[model samples]
Target: MYKLMASLLLGTSLTCAAAAAPANAKPYEHVLLISVDGLHAVDLANYVANHPQSTMASLQKTGVFYPNAVTTNPSDSFPGLVAQVTGGTPAVTGVYYDDSFDRSYFAADSKCQGNPGIEVNFAESIDIDDTRLDAGGTPGKPMTQIDPAKLPRMLVKGECKPVFPHDFVRVNNVFEVVHQHGGRTAWSDKHPAYEWLNGPSGTGVDDLYALEQDSLIPGSKVKTTGSFKAEREFDAAHVKAVINEIKGFDSTGANKQPVPALFGLNLQAVSVGQKLPKAGPGDDAGLIGGYADANGMPNSGLAVQLDFVDHALGELVGALHDSKLDDTTLVVIASKHGQSPIDPSKFQPTDEDPYTKMPGYAFHIADDASLIWLKPEERAKALTAATEYLKDQGKALGIGQLLTSNQVALAYQDPASDTRAPDFIVTVNPGVVYTGGKKIAEHGGSNANDRNVALLLSNPSIPPRTITALVQTTQVAPTVLQALGYDPKELQAVQKEATQALPGTPF
Candidate 1:
């Protein structure tokens, strides 16, 4: 009888406190974080200004819109996504680029012996254990490269590990925070490896549907000696999974009980065939079998992808409405990175050139843009050849830009330490794109066109307004945490001083 009386008194006091609170006092109960891999802010602006049928434009009419959301440097998908979810920079998260070098390990037979493989899992690599220590061994005698066949064994033997996002991110993500607070979580995306963005253990989310089976490949599709479809059916399957989860919430009274408090979905069909249609001299067009005709013009593909994503969102929103939880749910639509132009007819591959002969060298184009790989001993010579090549290519392509080894080092130079950067970095003039001989649109570098992406927030509590703040992807995680009423002080203390709160959110 005494216990019951105490419980009743506590419930009454809680009710009184809630009633006395201000109208804007209720913290958001659910947060939805969506990442469109290559959606551009400029493209969103154009859609809002002109495309009346755009779903994004419709959301903008009801939410806080930011037209100048930029990503951190290196602007690759892994780093961009990591920043968005962690509210941290590459300096803190260590996701510098898609392809980078690890000095600890070296391949006995390969020239690029110490380079780390793509798809780094930051959290797993950075723990107290030295999972990501250079492959060759330590910082001084790191392994230069691993034999392709030995990759699995190395991972099993714990000899080599992914760097950057996999090894570098040191903290829990916003989703994890929500989960810790008793909320369920789920995420769906084209790149399953993205699960690592949160951590190696896939913390925060209880369910994940990585649409592609293997994300290490350049394109998120299975390659059967080259012939492949740009759009994988698995994308649709993931959407179905999302729908099923939402439906399950309704059937089980999960929302009223303990449904997913946070969720995310990624749609990838639009960015699938990003390459140009034709192959040029010395290009790897034949390696992937002659290119297939693009399903539609690049712009058309984007529109379709957007529409498809919208349809899925519409379904999810409908589920929320039916569940009677619309008012408490906060939905965000954002992008990891933006796309660049792709015109394959201009590609020219040359083996006679020493720069082109370097490891990982694909083609030497005329746009101050060329892909080359160099050894540590050859770094100086490669830099000279790259600068001269850029001068000549700049005049030919009408874009005066050069990316030498010095420039590459300067771009990625650790503000805290002096370390050698990528052997060769492609610096392109405005409007020039690198196909990597794939003929599809791609983004893995730092450029205004590649770094700028979209950001939208919609919820009942937020007053509709357009914001033009210089928001970075790194701000997303902290913003989400703040919206959920989590103590963001810990995250803020570790983040850069410029960390931003979500615009128009009552925190």
Candidate 2:
């Protein structure tokens, strides 16, 4: 069966050149954008250096490797992923975190009444049944699986209307631009709530396969969140989807479809490998999965996960070659965020709840960092009190820098004006996770470990070189648009923020 598929792909490749002409006559016909969650830039550097025979090493010989790339502030998955696709930060995208609070929206049960400080949750909980593999939808069409009752609501002319994930975004993304300009687009992610990738128009991705990551493993009591082995299987399902799309079929492989001009998926195995501890969750063996030392060297379990991701990359590359899309396809490998506390010995988990006592505190999101929002009426006075309290208790709370609303306004919009901005942004000391979970590492902070992620742009026409100049994941949006011969200025946030394509690209 495998031999027949390869032969068929080879034949398809023979004719792909004539059939794969771009609408704008661009150099590249397709873009394979991949995000390996929790992959750090240093991790890529070490892996390539250590495994010279690996697929990443092969790409390094022809790819532009950005070693100093950083993600957005409040480096949670929602903002980090939006940065790469929209070329915007929270100020423009209006997405601080997946579970952050929004003062302009109403709670799920508000029904257009009462106060309007809604907890915006765009995670697996939005799925009709997050524990199922398909997220309570048919295999080929998962976008419809989002439960309207679980989404945030807004008063639309005296009537309460659910705000879908896509509608929550404030700007356009690369997927929207590409799809609007006569290109097929597809993406596979971990949750049905990832429909936000479709952009505000809700027409960016033609085929979106968002399988719930927390779904229960078949014949097992454990969820993928609690098992590294199940996590691999989850990743494999999405990988198989991408492979099917490579072979000119939909993600389900049951129907024929055009190969998407822009398509990719996110991998979660490496992330699970980083957070899971020795003999934790499903690991029967006592092998730990984090760094052995502070220098960022992977231990036995982490090394295995890295190997698995690399092997998956090889398979994707092989599929492209078999289908003859390798030359005309630009492969971009990046990460939404990276895990922190690489040195497990520095791990410090605290059960501190420092923000709830602050004057007029309405809500707070605390991970490695803390984002607090206060009632609007009391914000002015409460902000000052909270800053002083945080400073006075800095040592006890592991507060590194207490970014008052004034300081936060320097990078993002002023919380006084932006309904979604957090009144206080707190960066914590290294190795401090707010939750007392068994995981040794976490993200969602402004520290180096959480922000510095892997970024690589590989193509047949680009020269291989390492660019250490500081760049950002937001630059990826314009870079991808330019690669496809579209004007970067077409993106609203790119125009508003003056975002530029990544340097060192020949285009």
Candidate 3:
């Protein structure tokens, strides 16, 4: 009888102990997401198979690589980044383009006022009266400039007052979730307009390094004459700043005392001005001269870019290793969009072509889209002519579909606001290269080639393999959440099912 009682008691204790043990004890201590804008899955595969010296190549040997990672619709930087951070689509988040018309309630015009798409600047600084704008503003005082007292009334229904990170995102981002769970967050990037994505506050990023101010030398002959060269020094400085911040966190005991749950280092060099010459060819030398001769490929300016980006990646990876955070950190390398080949012969000023003529036509090949401003009197005529021209070009050049004002408006959920859409929005097709002068690359459209980019994840927790599944940029945020053992569903804005949870992660 004594032996039987002892055996029963011991068995019960063993059962309890087993139940108390964690199912999976390994946890990711940190996450470092890097965006190498314009990187394609094919490029990554080539690098890995060829044993290239790119930092990404080194990571591919042991990391999980996705060869067909797609981005959300509109496929521009704003939407791409939002998807990556919020795990939601454009229909949910409302960041449809680099510059979207303000569709929130307006007080002055009881009727919705359609803004001119070309004139709407995402990076422009505009003054707003919170009260009037919030109240939908009074007649004659448009919502763009409203009084502060009426702010309370104009708030959008079912929407929280814009808060950083959260306001920009319709759903909660990884940082918000991590921070809510008692984790720290930080990020560094080049887009100044990112401030508005989550509103002015509550972005959840404790440390933000954005290049808001243009460092271009004003009135300098180089800039004025369009002779500016890609500045590697500027790129290096941005990287160094990120490294310094990381070091600060480690040295100040921040890493030791509740280390950051999430952090990101954005290297803009790879995507900086698609037309800019890659590093090492010499300032003022065209991109063709930089890598065309050595790579045996057409002077497309991609090789130089690849080499430049690889160097920057190496520097960043080295920094992570030096900090002793490589193994425990989950790193993601991706791009917002891919570049379009630019043929130098396609160089014709807007003034030179009757169809392309428009006011404020600034042709910076590096910009994703060509911005055209038309005089009010010429708006109608210009719109029609441009539409016809684009259609003809689409057929002739084999570029992707050209969006009419109606299509653009319908896509935005407001067809009446078609006037606010770009007079002529051309969605360039894959392999249809546009070139002017010595510039050889460009991006900005809704084409599949431009939308599909690279997404690589490397960490001990993730199994070494390749996922050929169709994944959108929005899935990135939720995947990160799952890796950290958090439920993405808890966030009101994360509508996408967290389907991409990496190997070993509990969904």
Clashes of each: 35, 0, 22
Regarding lDDT, does 2 or 3 come out ahead? 2
Clashes of 3: 22
lDDT, candidate 3, 229-328, per-residue tens: 3344445545665565456553122343344567775554445444454323234454432123312232334554566667877776787788777777
Segments in model 3 whose C-alpha atoms lie over 4 Å from true places: 1-26, 50-53, 103-119, 124-169, 197-201, 212-214, 217-230, 250-259, 277-305, 342-399, 402-426, 429-438, 460-463, 496-507
lDDT of 1 at 23: 22
Which of 1 and 2 is ahead in lDDT? 2
| TM-scores of all predicted structures | 0.67, 0.93, 0.67
Query: Over the full model, what C-alpha lDDT does candidate 1 score relative to the true structure?
Result: 0.50
For all candidates in order, the CA lDDT equals 0.50, 0.83, 0.50
Q: Candidate 2: global Cα-lDDT?
A: 0.83
Ordering by TM-score: 2, 3, 1
Between candidates 1 and 2, the one scoring higher on TM-score is 2
Worst 10-residue lDDT window for candidate 2 reads 11-20
Query: Which candidate wins on lDDT?
Result: 2
Worst 10 residues of 3 by lDDT: 11-20
